[model samples]
Target: MWPDTTKVVLRQGPEVHIRPMVAADAEALHRFFLALPEEDRLFLEDDVTKPAFVQQLLAEQEAGRAFPVVAEASGEIVGYGVLYRPLFGWSTHVGRVRMAVARSFQRQGLGTAILRELVRKAQGLALDKLVAEVVEDQVGALRAFERLGFHREATLGNHVQDLSGKKRDLVLLANDVAHIWEHMEALVADFEPSAG
Candidate 1:
C-alpha cells in the first residue's frame, strides 16, 4: 500500500505534498486538467478536462487497473502521475507511466519528484519494466525521463495526432525497474520529507 501522504522539497525551494489520488479528487483533478494549456493537453490520450473522463480515471483506480498520484500545494493539485499495469496479459510485468505538472511549476523538479513516487510504487509492485510514450516535440518530458534513466526503445512514425489533427512521431522509452531504483539510489541528493 502507498503512504497516506508525504512532502518533498523541490529544487526551486518550495515544498509540495504528494499522495495517492482518491475518489474524492475527481472534481479537483478535472479542474487541474482544465487549467492546463491546450498544447500540454494535446498529446494526452483522453480529454481529461471532462468530468466523465475524471470519473473513469477514478473507476480505473477503484478496479486496480491504474494507480495515480497527485501533488498538492496550497490546497490545489499541481502535478499528477499514474501507472498503468495490465492485470492479465503477456506483459503483466510491465507498467506504463504518465505524468503532468502545472505550467507554473515546470522546470522546478516537480515532475521528477512525482515520477520518483511512481517509480517507488512500481518497485513495490515488482514491475519488471516501466515505459513512457512521448511525442517527438515533447523535449522536456523526453529529457526528464532520460534523466531518470529511461532509454528510447522505439520511435513510431506518425503514431499519434495532436489536438489540431497533426500527426506526430511517438517515442517509447523504457527502463528496468531495478535499474531505475539503482539510479534513484545513486542520485546526488534525495528529496526527503520537509520538516515542519
Candidate 2:
C-alpha cells in the first residue's frame, strides 16, 4: 500500500472550499479550462473537449499517480490545481503542479491556499520535491510560489510563443518538502494561523 494520503483542508476566507476532484467533475473542469485566458492556456497542454483526456486525468488521480483538486464556491468550480507525476523515471519522486483560478477569484488568497494544499498533497504522496513552471511575466504566480517556499531553479528562454507571435520565458520553481518542514516553525510564525 502507498503511504498515508496527504489532504489539506483549504479555506478561502470562509467562503470557498477546496477538495479533491472526481470523475464527475470533468465537465466543470472542462469549463474552467475553456474559460482560461489565452496567455494562461499556453502553459498547459490539453484538449478539454475530449472525454478520453478527461478520463485519463481522472484515472491518474485515482491510481495515486496524480492529484486534481477543485475550488468551489456555492457549488461552483472557481479554481483548479493539478499535480502530476514526472515524465522521467529518475525523477519519479518529483511532481509538477499546474494551477489556475478564475479571473474573478484571483488575488483573493485562493491561489495561495491552493498552492499550500498542493504542497501538502505532494508531501503526503512521499514526493521529495514539487515543481512549477510559470511564464516570466506572471509575476503574481511566481511571487505566490516563492512565498510558499518555492525557489526559482531555472529560466527556459523563449519556451513558449503566444498567439500574437510573442515569445515568453518559462521560469522554473522547486520546493524541497523536507527543507521546508525544517523551517516550519519560523514559517508558521510569520503568518497568522487560520483554520483550513
Candidate 3:
C-alpha cells in the first residue's frame, strides 16, 4: 500500500532510515513527538503524545484512510509524514499532507525525502491533487513544500490557534499530483541536504 523503505544520507553525513509507519511504532512515535519543541508541533491537529491517538492512526492506516510514515536517524525517530485521503467528499480527488522533522534534523533533506514518497504514493493511487496546510510563520515548511513545486493556493485567516493562544493563518498550498509524480525522481536526486 506504500512505497518501499529507503535509506538516505543526510547533509551532515549520517544515514537515516525512512519507511512506512507500523503498529509497533506507536511508542516510538509518541517519543518522537515528545522530543519536538512545542513550537514545531503547535499546529498539528492530532495529539500524537497519547497512545490512543497512535492506535487510531494505525486503525486509519489499516482501513486505507491514512498513510503515515516515519524517519529514524541513529535508531531514534526524527521525522514523520502523514497523508490523508477522504473516501467520500468533495476532496476525494485530493490528499492532504502533514509532516515534521526534528529541530536538529531540519535542514537535512529528510522532509523532502518524505514528501517525495508521499507524492509518489498519491500518484499511484491516481490522486489528482495534493495539498498541505502550513502555518503562516513557518518559513522553513513553506519553503520545503514550495521546493517540491506546490504553489500557494489560498490563506485562511485565523485558521489555527497556537499554544500561546495566538491566532495563526493557514497557508493552503497545492500541486497537481501527476505533475509531481512525473518529476519526482529529479526532485529526489537534486536534494542536497548540505555538506556542512
Candidate 4:
C-alpha cells in the first residue's frame, strides 16, 4: 500500500513537505503557472491561459489516472510535480513525470524533494518505469533526474521549439525501479519508510 505521506530533505537543506494535490489547489496552481517565466513555461505544453485546462487537470486527478503533488514551504506552494499514466494497455505500467519550481525556490532542494515523492508514488503503483522528457538546454534538470537514478534512453532532435523559434532537443530519461534498487542500494536506504 502507498503511504499517506512521504518526506525528504532538499539537497543539503531543510525538510520540505509533500502531499497530494487537491481540488482546492486549482487556483493556486493557476497562479503558479501564470507566474512562471517564459523559459520555464516553454517546456510545458499546457494552455494555462484557458481555465478549462486547469479544470481538466483537476478532473484527471479525481479520476485516479494521474498523481499531482505540491511542495510546500511554510504553507506556500514552492513547486509542483505530476506523474501521468499512459492509456494503452501495453504502456499502462509506464509513467511520465513533469516538475516545475518557482524561480525563487529553484536550487533550494524543492525539486529534489518533489522528485523523491514522485518516485515513491510510482513505486507504490508497481510501475515498471518512470520516464521524463527534458529539454536539452535544461542541464540542471537532467542532472537532477540523474541524481534520482534516471538514465538517458533516447534523444529526440528538434522535439520542441522555444519562444525564440529555436529548435530544442528532447532528452528521454527512464528509471527502472528494480534495476535502480539492485544497483544503488545505498541510495534507496533513506527512501524506505514504513507503510502507514
Q: Best-fitting candidate, measured by lDDT? A: 1
Better of 3 and 4 by lDDT: 3
Question: If candidate 4 were superposed on the true structure by all CA atoms, what would the RMSD be?
Answer: 3.4
Each candidate's clash count: 0, 0, 0, 0
Candidate 2, residues 111-153, lDDT tens digits: the string is 7666666667778778898789888988878887787778999
* Collision pairs in model 3: none
Better of 1 and 2 by TM-score: 1
Q: Any idea how many clashes model 2 has?
A: 0
Instruction: Report the number of the highest-TM-score candidate.
Output: 1
With a 3 Å backbone cut-off (N, CA, C), the pairs that clash in candidate 1 are none
Q: Model 3: per-residue lDDT, tens digit, 1-196?
A: 5767878788778788888998888889989898888878877776666778778888989999899999988789999998889988788999999998999888878888788778877877789999999998988889888877889999999988887789989999999997776565676567654321
Q: How many backbone clashes does candidate 3 have?
A: 0
Off by over 4 Å in 2: 1-14, 45-53, 180-194
Task: Give the better candidate number (1 or 3) by TM-score.
Answer: 1
Better of 2 and 3 by TM-score: 3
- Tens digits of lDDT, candidate 1, 52-160: 9878778888888899999999889999999988899799999999999999988777887788788889988889999999998989889989988999999999999
On lDDT, the stronger of 1 and 4 is: 1
- Please rank every candidate by lDDT, starting with the best: 1, 3, 4, 2
Please give the distance, in angstroms, between residue 11's alpha carbon in candidate 1 and its true position after superposition.
2.1
TM-score against truth, every candidate: 0.94, 0.79, 0.91, 0.83
